[model samples]
Target: MTQTTPTTPVPPGALDGTGESSKGEATDNRARSRAAGPGRLLAIVLTGQLMAVLDVFIVNVAAPTLRADLHASGSGLQLVVAGYTISYAVLLITGARLGALIGHRQAFLAGLTVFTAASLACGLAPGTGALIAFRFIQGAGAAVMLPQVLSLIQRTFTGASRAQALGAYSAVLASGAAAGQVLGGVLVQADLFGTGWRPVFLVNVPIGLVLLILGPRWLGGAEERPESRAGGGAAGRSGALDLAGLLLLAAAVLLFTVPMVLGQEWGWPLWGWVMLGLSAVLAAVFAVYEARLAGRGGAPLISPRVAGAPGMPLAIARIVLAMAANAGFLFVMTLHVQGALGYGALRAGWTFAPTAVAFGLVGLNWRRIPARWQPVTVPSGFLLAAVSFAGVGLALRDGSDGGPWLFAALVGVGTGLSFAYSPVLTRTLATIRPQDAADASGVLVTSAQLGMLTGVAVFGAIFLGHGPGVDASADALWATCLALAGAALCGAIVGLVIRVGHLR
Candidate 1:
């Protein structure tokens, strides 16, 4: 009865819960090897991100062609652009959460598949309504995919490697955004595959296909941390989902953004104000709910705890303000180029090329820029941009038709440096805890989207209220420049705050 075979007991900490460290020295070695090796997966992810960002500006250059072919009204055209943006912005928080719940790699692949299919639908849509619908879907896919790219890099790499990856990500963003207008112009003008403006959407299909094929082989499996698997069983999956929070967030964004996009077109009707009021109420309610969830030790959609972090909210505010000013500048400049200068779409697109080139070049050197210099860069960018805007106003006032090239070049330099701010915000955020990273990213993106929405609305109203006039060109340009200068001043103030805070 006492003949029990002696068994060797496993030592404490032998199994490091999630099995992340259980692979021992060999696993660490492998991770280091992968980190040092050329990352095919990273490249694929960046390409997808580049495509998503590019789509934001690509259609701007093709708007006229789309209007003619689809017989879309001015509102319809705005919807084509706004639809994607609003959808993407709304889903960003939810997407990040979902990616965390299911593996990031799986989420990325799933999003790519959806986006690729939606692109096909967009290209094939017979009318404006259909196109707008598909664009919304495409944007939703983009929301899901974009977050995973950042998360995967964060998970896969460490230290200097992480910084390098982020820098590369930044470079892709700058280059893709700049290239969009040029590529769209070329594609639209060429009438590729006899598809009119359809090729712009269709071009994504091949790119998506390549990503789908290579993703499985290159992305590797999800590396679950010990804490992630602590609860075990269905609890692990349930912890990931956060369904109620996601629904509330989605509702909050829709209620807010819909009015902003549609209110001007509808003459700011009673319904629109009602929606806005509802949105504010819903936002408040959502905030309370998230707080309660956090208190209960449950994961909220955005995680209220992170919002309370020092510098996070301030960073978000700065991002929103800067983006608003930038968007307004673009809106006014577009009109100035096309209406006042009488330049065609292709020529107007080309005018912004120098900015793109400069941005790409500067973005590559972002890694070397110190964190302390980040605040400085923002103000400097705004100052340069303000000067460029002033130059435009001066030229318009002087009735000089031919010197836009020089003014645009100055704007280009400003825009190039403008590329640094977001990355700077990202870098500042790297100090945050891992669990809060997704929320930070979401906040950063949401602020930028809101800024864009506000910018378009405010600047569009200013431009339209003044009415179209050749003689009024100088007045319009001056008014826009003053507004931009005001924005720059705000950015400067924020930079000062950052500097002072650091001093403390």
Candidate 2:
């Protein structure tokens, strides 16, 4: 062989396929050292998560108080709940894309700051109109903060640490709603030095402040991947946010949500149906627009490819139906027990304690589960929940006995917890590349939020449409519980399909 000019040798592994990834991991380790330790980072993120979840559930408890204190109309109260959820859901994709452009840590701080300030405004709001407006803004803040949680966890940790962190996150997700119900009752009952329901919002003030001040120091810059930067990837510097797509998506969601929120109060007016029809058209338009954009190699608010992946559509559908029914179950049960059974707020709160406990016990230990077995957990869990819910319906039908009802609720919650901690998220987004994880997280969360909105609107409409009475309330509870069982059945089917498909 002819002698070649001497050249510097590349270090071993330097030019290997994994070299870049190894370098990235090293960089992340260095950055983590400069920032907060894993424990502190976990605390900061989990606290943010708890606040968001608490706000969603706590408001249900505060509905009656809102109506009484602010002289809110039925539709207005619905708006107070729906407004926050709608805004939160609508803006999530934009929020995730934003975190990529700026930095997740920065976005998280900005969101927390805004959320804290808005909570203060909500506490001080003098009228129903003002409260609704503030709640929307608060929700917008939540949209920004929530996506950062998953993104940061992925970026900051690895291996066993990642597993542990995710387990805690899931536990909080499982328990947050039930915990909120109980906490909301205690605060409302205490009245917090005559603040009435205001303290529910006010309590976030101190907690949020501490997070805001230290968050920047504790959380460092996001670990951005080079390929991810070009699209909806981690810390991607996408040319620009697809504002047109965002607007279209927002319009579609608003169309669907507004009718659901206002239809009952307006006596199921013709216009509401028209809006629902329009929502379908707009949703179709959004889908088409996203496809065309993706075809052109452009960034869409939600990546069309990811949304259309194998299991994603099914996952979204399952989440919407199951979560909607779950939300409706909480609402109708609260109304029936407090309204018809004459149970105090505290008593009503205690009704869900077993669910909360079960969720905590199972969810915190979710990581101990082996990967191979995790796939079957979701369907099994849902089946158990379905049986428990049917039992609740049977109890309600048989004179609403306290012992049977509470026992069913306990078993339902525990069963719900057992399987709800499954890796549905990872399975659903299995086709999604690591670069697009944040975008997938955003889409997943948005679907869940919309599901909650659907639950409140459709179920609330049913409850209000029947007018007020012990009998009407009982009917509403029975209807809602049956619906929950049905929803769980649907979930079980979807889960089984996914699992069977995997076996192939």
Candidate 3:
């Protein structure tokens, strides 16, 4: 009998001279690829986030130039700013759903692309109407992009990694806002590309281009679900797109915001009142529709359950009120310095730099504050902000020259304290389900935007109605600051309630 040696078949690329080396090299490549993947995605997403946040403030310094160039009136100027914010707020929920349905990465890229194009259109806008319309579209795009950032970070990372990523995200958000103001000032001052105020919008083009190009490669596709992988459920979740709900919400916001913004300018016209009535009706209808959907187990545009959560609505209300006060303070300060005090735009922009610097410094050490101290810090910060506002009021009353510096420093300190707990709020909300997180964030942003719009309108109305004389302006500003202080007092009360209720 022949001795038969059984030859075992080696696996593909197993141990042939270079085969093991090749396998090891392949493994190394994959490990490196995976390791680099999330970081790359984060960078791209943060860039997009930065762009979105930047747009919010980038136009502030350029507002005067834009107004002059486009022949826009005060109302038109408000539209230019408020139109974007209003549209952005209305579309946020829809955008989030769209991202979930179509795909986050695809949606993010598409939104970025649209936003970039709209930025160009805004730069080239031939008239005020064109600029306003384009800004609305740009805002729509931003609405789509911003939510996915949170979604992406949440879905991608987990555990401590997720916390760290979120912290970074929050920091980027603050930095982007601060940078927008500074960069807008610089660009307007420098007259880069000779585009004048247009460069503020145009600058987004290159940054956006970089994001669009790199995004797909870095962001990967949406996470594959277990059910999706098993092919046993809908590929993406199944729920109607809620177009009716969306339209109603849009109508409601427009009816409410348009009238609020234009009412004072148009002398509280019949049309404004009509729109206000219509807005109320639309809001009621929206509520009914949402309730119906909820009862049917269909996903409502917003989750009523989350919205109705204990303390959440109150928390949001306080946030809105506080933001409204902040907006009024900013508006009055801007007008006082540039319009009344005859300071140049550059000088005015520089005036706020101290506040920004202080905010950044405090924000850097935010983590050092104990968790238990967050409740105290938030209210204390508000109190400080109120005091700062009062200081400005006093400075105005005293007719002190170069007084904005002291007030600005106080503002910086107050802002730093005010934001100290934002991270804590974010983490607390994150513990909720993903959809809840989305709903909560949407609600918070909406409240903040509305507060800002309302603040400007209310404060501006008071100022203009009384006339913009030095004394009148000063009085209006002081009253506005006092109102904000009242709001901070309210927030403090709420904080106490939260602490007490939690104890109970």
The lDDT leader among the candidates is 2
After superposing candidate 1 on the true structure, give the runs of residues whose Cα lies further than 4 Å from its correct spot.
1-38, 223-240, 369-375, 396-420, 495-504
Candidate 1 vs 3: which has more TM-score: 1
| Worst ten in a row by lDDT for model 3 | 1-10
Q: Write down the worst ten-residue block by lDDT for model 2.
A: 1-10
**Per-residue lDDT over 1-504 for candidate 3, one digit per residue giving the tens place of the 0 to 100 score:** 111111323233221112221232334334433754877888888888888877877788789999988889998897897777777767776776666556567778888999999999988889999999999999999988887787666545544445556666655555455466677778888887677898899988998988888877788754433212222112232434567777898799788888776677678899988998999999999999989977886666776645664446555655666666655666667777677677666766666666555555554455566755544555666666666666667667644444655656456534643463344344344433343444555566666667767777787676666566677666776676666666656654565565455668
Clashes of each: 0, 1, 0
Which lDDT tens digits does candidate 1 get at residues 1-504? 011111223233221112222223334535733753438877888999988988877897788889999999988998997798889888987777666667667888889999999999999999999999999999999999887777666555544555567667755664565578767877887887678899999999999999899887778765443115433211142466567767777887887788787777666789877877888888888888878877887766665545755456556656677667656666666667778777766777676676666666565565466755543565566566666666656666654563755657445544634543545554544544444445555666677777767776676666656657665765776687777667766665665665456568
Each candidate: RMSD to true structure? 9.8, 8.1, 12.6
By TM-score, the better pick of 1 and 2 is 2
Better of 1 and 3 by lDDT: 1
By TM-score, the candidates rank as 2, 1, 3
lDDT of 2 at 25: 56
Model 3 accuracy (lDDT, Cα): 0.66
State the lDDT of candidate 2 residue by residue for 1-504, as single tens digits.
111111323233321112232344545554674576777888998899889888888877777877898888888898887777767777887777777767677788888888899999999999989999999999999989988787676566554455566667766765777788888888888887788889889989999999988777677545444235434452353556778888888888788877766676678789889988998999999889888887886777776656765567666766676567666667667777788777777777877777777776776665456755555666666777777776776676544545856676665756573455434543343344435656777887778777877776777666655557776666666666667777777777765565555568
Candidate lDDT values, in order = 0.67, 0.70, 0.66
